[model samples]
Target: MDRQFYIISYDIGDPKRLQRVHKFLKDYGKPVQKSVFECWLTERELESVVSWLADFIKRTEDRVRIYRLCRNCLQNVEFTGPVYFAEEPPEELIL
Candidate 1:
């Protein structure tokens, strides 16, 4: 399966909701900043994430943005500080 890179950022008005959103995103991506994440996902995964967010957040008070990065664009990403990339879990084989 092919995965595309994305930047997901959000602003939540409530502290509880902010924590919930952050926790939920951690399952999918790496946290690049306090409210920003870097994710590599398939189309279905992305759609599911957005769908979940649509139903969870307040339409008027919370804001979520997803930015897709092409291979070329991802190559051009520049940052000065220490950066972390998400590591894939090791595959387990059961005998």
Candidate 2:
């Protein structure tokens, strides 16, 4: 299976809804920023994440953006400042 990388960011209006979205994303990826996550998923997994969030968010007020990264893009990502996230994905993720 080929897994692709995605950067998911959101601006949710309600605190409760924001927390829910954060928790849901934890199951799919790692947090790279307060409102951003980096996910390595297969196509189906990506679809699942979007589908679940579609129900959790209010289209009229909240915004969610999922940015797909090609292998070349991943390799070229530049990091500066405090490093709370891994520069590269783990070789193996348990669970």
Candidate 3:
């Protein structure tokens, strides 16, 4: 399966809901900030992730965004200053 990159961000009105979302994202991606995550996922996984999160947010009060980045866009991403909070994937997985 091919995986595409996605930047997922959220703003939840309730503290409990925000925590829930945070925990969930941790299982699936790398957290770049308190409420932002960077994920590489297949189309099916992306849909599943969004569907799961939909259960936790209120339409009127919470906001969630998922930005799909093409290979070109991902390559063109720019960063500045210290990135202490940035998440790095493991260099190797040992089984």
Candidate 4:
């Protein structure tokens, strides 16, 4: 495996707060699931991003889950460019 991306998920309490987090990660990562994001990061970058993710998650009232993956662990990763979410809700939930 050359480079790998991690799939991180968040179970948010409020639809509003969940959207906030989804936006944050989208600006920095890729949104795979509704509230789950996939990011391709180097080891150092991943670690730093995870730390930042933890801080972001802690700020939310929702339950957040992150999965940091190795090259061998990924099933399918569509390398979409960085995503930036809106302040308002998405027109449709990407489940």
Best by lDDT: 1
Candidate 3 lDDT tens digits, 1-95:
66777889999999999999999888778888799998877788888899998887899999999998887886677789755323434444557
Stretches of model 3 off by over 4 angstroms after superposition: 83-95
Query: Which pairs clash inside model 3?
Result: none
For model 1, give the 10-residue run with minimal summed lDDT. Answer: 83-92
1-95, model 1: which lDDT tens digit per residue?
A: 56788899999999999999999999889998999998988888899899999999998999999999887886687879885565544434678
| lDDT for model 2 | 0.86
Per-residue lDDT of 17 in model 1: 98
Each prediction's whole-model lDDT (CA)? 0.87, 0.86, 0.82, 0.62
Summing lDDT over every window of 10 consecutive residues in candidate 4, give the lowest-scoring window: 84-93
The residue pairs in collision within model 2 are none
Q: Report the lDDT tens digits of candidate 4 across residue range 1-95.
A: 23355667878777776777787777556676687776765566666766766776645466766666655544344447854321222234457
Q: Residue 89, candidate 1: how far off, in angstroms?
A: 7.4
Best by TM-score: 1
lDDT tens digits by residue: candidate 2, 1-95? 67888899999999999999999999888898899998888888999999999987999999999999998887687879864433444556559
- Model 2, position 39, has a per-residue lDDT of 86
For model 3, what is the alpha-carbon lDDT of residue 35? 92
Best-first order by TM-score: 1, 2, 3, 4
- The local lDDT score (0 to 100) that residue 8 gets in candidate 2 is 96
Error of 3 at 12 (Å): 0.4
